[model samples]
Target: MGRNGVDRDRYQASQSCSDRFQGAFGAPRAEREQQFSKFMEHLPLAVSIKDKSGRFLFANEFMKDLLAADDPVGKTLGELLPPEEASMMAVNDHQALTQGLLLIQNRVNDTYGDERIFETYKFPLPMPEKRTLLGSISVDITERKRAEQALALKQQQLEELNRSLEQRVQQAVDELRQKDRLLIQQSRQAAMGEMINNIAHQWRQPLNNIGLIIQNLQLQYEAGEMDSEQMATEVGKAMDVIAYMSRTIDDFRNFFHQDKERQPFVVNQMVSRSLDFVLPGLKNSGIDVECREEPNVSADGYPREYMQALLNILNNARDVLLERKVKQPLIRIAIFRENKRSVVTIHDNAGGISDDVLPKIFDPYFTTKEQGKGTGIGLYMSKTIIEKNIEGSLTARNVDGGVEFRIVV
Candidate 1:
């Protein structure tokens, strides 16, 4: 009887423990389901579960916020979205559920006098029954779309600005190159003129000597006293005059050919050559030239052409001074170095240029000389050569007694 009572007590205790375990675990599961429902109530994106028939099985807090209603479950999407959108959404959801596919769409939602764009994805549930469509996520893309559009507009504007700037820069470069070519051609022409003038002056003295020699030869021949040696000497003198003229032609040819190529040359030597070309005219016109020795001023490109430009300026000054009948027709040429720049100053005692004409001196076709005497391109060409070709500067200033042309490179 004692053994039977022990077995019965043990059986009753086991049953009681099993009942307590079932109750504890079951109540917690119910509580957990309630908590999960509360959590889904406050999601930010509209959350919904739908059946294959496009009826809502569940709608979360966000859905309620979107619809401004409660108990939206079991309702068709047509009750929420506009008729067109609702029909489209229902079709997309039905396709996703039936075909086990995913659908993504970008669509606009209108509310309160504004439009909001959303990107929505409808995906099928993995359940085999195909009765449930698992989930849909809609993201607000309105601000992002606006920003992208703004960025595209700005990019287009930037491209346009770059194109305009490139065109303008190219135009400027072309203009500069055109100016350079014109200046070079003008320099060649001016050098040719000076060379011709020098030849004319050189021939005068030689022609006079020849004339005197011929007169003597004729007198001796008529008297029947012409000597062979004397004749030879006279012939030799005449030949020397011809040879000198030939050499002058050669020099002029070389000067005019300066546009062929560029090479480094001594500045002083170039200056000397230029002076030789203009010296005869200067002497004949009685214009005194004073040039200072420039030991340190050397250039690296187109030595002959550069010297031609300088000589043209000096010759122009000389002509101006002589034309004005200045009592002391003086042209001062000086070259010095300052701040890594070559400075050439050509000043003349020609009472300075007139204020009325100063501003137009460097303009093409603007000259103070009478017709056929000046082409008016000399100063303009000079400025172009110095500034555009050599990357230098040329400026004219009126001093107390004369006009000074300052060139810096």
Candidate 2:
């Protein structure tokens, strides 16, 4: 409005309030001009007017404080601002002159060297003498921009975390499946070894009987007493023993068969079948075994796994009896129903397990036997089969004079 400074008279002459508010509000020229100057000085927004050449013609009090400049009038943006910011302002001024209106968002450093964002509106104003001025108002938007940036970063982090969690879960599932396969293989290996030992014990008596029958036939022939009826009788007795030995193989095969489905089966029957495979060894070892069966007690689960668990317990009992060789060695199996569940208890008199060793008996790879003699997964797998697969429980405790293993289904 004035050269080298703001001239009070020139600034007052530029006020067009009277023309805008004529009949509705009447006031003296001086009074209206003072009101306009006061209003512009107190406004919160940064307001300024520039010539077509991007030179500041007028700047409000807020604009002066925003730029930290002593006087902005008659100064070009290039002279008043840093090179990069001046260049950006120059471009915006040119667009406002050519396009009539321009709106933009920009980043700039304030007088304190702190960064700030501004949403600016620029428009052209035609003056009386064919001259044009560009007017602009800007509001700080730094907080809003920072919030948007922070929200975007958080969303990205959450997505990456979700992906990482999915990968970890899949890896865990794969590991569990591998462990299951290993357990099954180990169980089969243990069962196979037990079967071989039992078969040896089972066949020994029948083989010796056949040998004796052959010896008897020789003796009869030498004496000239061999008759057709006597020969048939001797042969029939030998065949019966051989047939009984053959059935042992069938029993072993059925015991190891993998069952795919669960069904209701008598608990006592399953326990008896498991004992059949080990009875010969028990007899030969002179470890007396007695079964006290209770009728009509049934369960719903994998019968083969149930049998395997029972066999493992029995085998453990047999081993302890033989290893310790307790006087009058005895192992007792009892099956009955209690609390609406089938229960089986196997008790052995071998001085029971030591207090320290009893607690860890069901832990995987923990064995009392020498390294090559025990796979240790037997009791652990048995626990898994009963608790997880069969939805039942297996527990061990020291009784009055022996160790008791109990299964509840």
Candidate 3:
């Protein structure tokens, strides 16, 4: 499909998500007012609401400012935006309303005539009187797109350089070593983005707590209840949250630091530690993850490199579940010893990959994800690390409902 074309799939929001904003029955009036306030003022993403008749019902400040509109409500797309942009949005809106939730990429030139790309999620929002309105959350992805394009160009240049070097130097060992260095460099670059996302997940709750603490202090002060005990208590709570965030940063920094030499590590312990880096994001996505480990299993290798491989596999599982919108998504990890070899298996219930794609899953630059979302080197580097660097075995198979990856060292 072309860049302008929509890549769509059926979507239903999860119950846990629905419960957050609306319980089994519905949100209370006061709670809904608070949500409205946050949605309109605090949200940084552009959001819009449109009725079936194509007249805008409402738009958040971000969306309004983007369009430079005095007021968007009661204005049709054709009346509010440039014809080409309006037409594109109108078509997308219609599809979202009729066909269920849609994730689409759109390029638009706002009133200022500056073009920007957006990654938008449009869904049908049920309303009072059994009415349905189109709701959208759009995030500007122009910078992210540019970064992906640059990374792709750099990868192409590296491939060309490698070809030239292979022709000039006939030493097989040296060429292989050079390729390994480049692979590690590329893997780190790709993994860094996900690590940052994990960092955000690690800090989200603490940040929210700190914000509430500040709000409480304000309320207490205004009500003349700000005693020394309360003052010390709130300040302490804020400090503790700050400390936790600091420790999270330290953990991430250590995870990414290159290992200088091989080291002995406990298998179960390493698996637990590896989960720490990614568990937060996985849970936030509502994926159920369970670890069943037989303790005391040991392995000898570069622990950091081994952890990187685990990160790649776990991330791929998460992406698959999210992309497929699988119900009750679950990832189960088991660690044990088989035939005196330390074994770790990770499996997920997202539908298994196709037969034709399974054999090439470990091949570099082979990805099933849409453009700019995947570099296709993660699994390749992962297999290389386990089999080559760690001298371990990594294999994959299609289980009954999903895929399983086993690692032995």
Candidate numbers sorted by TM-score from highest down? 1, 2, 3
lDDT of 2 by residue, 165-256 (tens): 88888889789767966896788779889978989998998999999998999899899999999899899989999898889888888877
Model 1 Cα lDDT, one tens digit per residue, 109-221 = 44454677777767765433333344676766778989999999999999999999999999998897787677667656766776788889877887888888889889998
Per-structure clash totals for the candidates: 0, 0, 0
Alpha-carbon RMSD of each model = 11.7, 7.9, 40.3
Q: Single out the weakest 10-residue window by summed lDDT for candidate 3.
A: 5-14
Worst-scoring 10-residue span by lDDT in model 1: 9-18
lDDT of each: 0.73, 0.84, 0.84
User: Which has the greatest TM-score?
Assistant: 1
| C-alpha RMSD in Å of predicted model 3 compared with the true structure | 40.3
Which candidate has the highest lDDT of all?
3
Model 3: lDDT of residue 267:
85
Best of the two (1, 3) by TM-score: 1
